[model samples]
Target: MRSRWGKARRVSTLEGPAFMNELQRAVASMGPRVLLFLTEEKTVNTVSELRASLPVSVLIRLPEHQRLMELMHKQGFQELAEAMAAPVPRTVRLQSSQDLPLVRGLNYPCVLKPSEKNYEYGARFKKAYKVGSAHEVDALYRKIEPVLADMVVQEWIEGADGDIYFCLQYIGGQGEVVSSFSGRKIRSWPPRIGGTASCTAAWEHAQELSDTTASFFRQVGFTGMGSMEYKRDARDGLFYMVEPTVGRTDFQEEVATVNGCNIPLAAYCHEMGQALPAMSPVSPQRVWRDEQADRWSREVSGEAVNAAALTGFPVVDAQWRWHDPLPWLDDISRRAADRIKSKFHK
Candidate 1:
């Protein structure tokens, strides 16, 4: 991303209200033309007001919704799915310790998740817990009930990491698809219990998955970058909706760029009312890997990179690049400092 823009960039660590103030000042200093891709809940929620106050041409990722960003919550996506008659797993939401019994009726090996990430509960279970039985769910709830007010328990979708497919779309405000991409996970850290470790472009199923995503957003009147993860059930050969990442790009967004679709660029062009870039052929065989996370998964779970993902294909790493050395270098420097500090403590 840095290489495309040259050295002119304004990076900030300030968040919430403070970040909004900085953003206002930044637009004033940088002039009217601005393209924003945001993840912060506070900044996203309040940007429409800021735009209305100033004569600035601002393009943001999410729709102007005044809400904090959360993940795997009891509300939002699940409700949307059910209302629209979409494919979703039966879920048991735990608002308090009293709701623990609600999960007992679920099928064994259910997936347990903290409703939101704004709590200490995420520190222990980074993604979710696949409990093998009712007893295990009860034991885990004893520890989680004290930390979080809400949680989710759903019947486990039977599939390996490779069965996980995702569709990312840049939906225009007037209900048009500006750009879209479809891909699948080859592996995940924590062996299906955590975040993506590696993934590749799903060439064969791209059209179908892409259409499914575009239709989803169109029906809901969503206008922004939206992504939906679907897991293909091995037992039934059906795809179940996992979750929707609304208002921003997916974490593995660059995978689309590597595969010949630059979603960010397309969205920016559309916002500026410019001609769309000529879409090119994707590197269908390329795999994108979070190298560090893959290594961690290997160390902790004896997980190996799928041979299908590597054989006769290029593996694009998450950070390292010849032109963009700073990001990779910074990662190395930070890890080295941490190692030295640990040695001194020992």
Candidate 2:
């Protein structure tokens, strides 16, 4: 990926023995000047484990081991929020069949989610399930409990997908805020409880959002690229923080970059001890869309997929870029293959 300094190199996933060999070769070739930024948990763990042997500095935002443990696990995150006095949905942790009865009195239409959203657990089930009543919760719990090591039942926040908002910020090693940007979701695939498909840059209610995020991170002693997802309750006008995706760049962080602050780039410069780039004044509202997912969302929701309305505002395509077209092409190819396979199986 192109950064302000230059192009960033990516290492493809490899088999165990080959990966170690490649890692040693890459480190030797690149030397100590290279900084490793890990995006996933597995990568983070691997790099951290090998940090003593590696010569290069790993640019991990959450360097504190305890903080990383708390933020990465759902139940740990709830405890962290409570300790910070931050507002989060009421959550009941279930570790075994003995605790299953806790689901009985939970508010109807609550959500059930695995406490640890690790790769294996996520692959086994969708992120979360919404149950309307106790009976439904019991049934779903019975099916998943045996397989899941940990789980939680949380109150479902009532709001449209657009009500979801994010605060993306870069905190320096000294616990200083280098850059911050906020945006609201326009829509998402899978309607509610899905990844963002369409979103826009906005500062509306940003101060409050920024305060909560900054306070939480400060308490946790976190630094580097971090983001928190929140949803504003339409009826009460209060924002409840859903969770924090600390120590990595958000998927739609480009929305913030195009708007004004380039958080990831800012973090890179901060770590390198270079002068930070001046942030552009938050410009007029800009929209970003994952075209394929946004179109699919419209179709599934039975909403008019109006092209004219999108044209009224400046739009940034999330995937398609002239400079980097291969990733988009690969996505298209994979999607096509999936569709063809489905047709044949039917």
Please give the range of 10 consecutive residues that has the lowest summed lDDT in model 1: 64-73
Indicate the TM-score of model 1: 0.89
Which residue pairs come into collision in candidate 1? none
Q: Please give, for residues 216-257, the per-residue lDDT of candidate 2 as tens digits.
A: 888888877788999988778789988877666777888887
RMSD (Å) of each candidate, 1 decimal: 2.8, 3.0
lDDT of 1 at 232: 94
Model 1 ranges off by over 4 Å: 1-14, 41-55, 64-74, 301-311
Tens-digit lDDT string for candidate 1 (1-346):
3453454446474354556666676667665688877654334445543546433555564554532133224466677678778788888888887888788789877888866555377666557889898788888887878777677888899998889999988988787999988889877887787778878888889898988878877766677877889999999988888888776667899888888888889998998889988667565467888888777866676645443434456888898888778778888889999999999999
Assess candidate 2 and give its TM-score to the true structure.
0.89
